[model samples]
Target: MIHLEFNSESENEGIARVLAATYMMKFDPTMEEMADVKTAVSEAVTNCIVHGYEDDQGKIFMDISNEGSVLKIVIEDFGVGIPDVKQAMEPMYTTKPDEERTGMGFSFMEAFMDKIEVSSESGKGTRVIMEKKVTGK
Candidate 1:
């Protein structure tokens, strides 16, 4: 298991992706699996920065672990939580349309990972849990 906590900065998105990929290396995942996991991590971290914090700085927590071939990831942010998680997950539905945000973050995450679950409170925070099966191991 690996746990990470970092500032909700845009640059940290890449860091999180790299760290996830590096940690998965021990499982000898395929290139496609690596890319999928990296993309999912990127989207999760980006959401924490662009939407969760929304120009404010906060801590993002991530926990990663594997059980057999299944990889599990949980990312959390203590920022302005989503008022409606179901609406937010809909494709092409973005609150910040003026910023050219495509609202595909959750879509991409669901596409790349085998399973994803999200929970949020209006004034508390948001948590995203994702799981994938790495077959290369």
Candidate 2:
């Protein structure tokens, strides 16, 4: 398992993607699968930056674990948590409507990852755990 924590900033989204891709490389996934992993990671990190912190300063924690053919990722933030996780997961559900957010972050993550789990506390934080199975290595 590899752990990373960084400022909850938009620029860190790319860092999260690259880290996920690099870790998955050892699994020898196909190009398409790599893309999927990157996209899923990006969405999770973006959520932490945009929604969790809501532009306030905070820290985002990410954990990546590789178990044979499975990769599990957990991204968390100790910021303003979601009040309605179910509603947030739905596509086209954006709290920041004025910012032009597409509200597809969770949808994209679900589409790419095999499984996803989210838990949040109103004033505590939000945690997103996702897993993907890679074959062909």
Predicted model with the maximum TM-score: 1
Record all residue pairs in model 2 with backbone atoms less than 3 Å apart, i.e. clashing. Answer: none
Write candidate 2's Cα lDDT for 1-137 as tens digits.
89999998788899989999889888889999999989999988888888888859899999999788899999999989999999999999998889879999999999999999999999999999999999844
Please identify model 2 stretches exceeding 4 Å from their true place: none
Clashing pairs in 1: none
lDDT of 1 by residue, 1-137 (tens): 99999998888889899998988888899999999999999999998999889989999999999998899999999999999999999999999999969999999999999999999998799999999989884
Whole-model Cα lDDT per candidate? 0.94, 0.91
What TM-score quantifies how close candidate 1 is to the native fold? 0.97
Task: Please report, as a residue range, the 10-residue window in candidate 1 with the lowest summed lDDT.
Answer: 18-27
Q: Quote the lDDT for 3 in model 2.
A: 97
All models, RMSD in angstroms: 0.9, 1.0
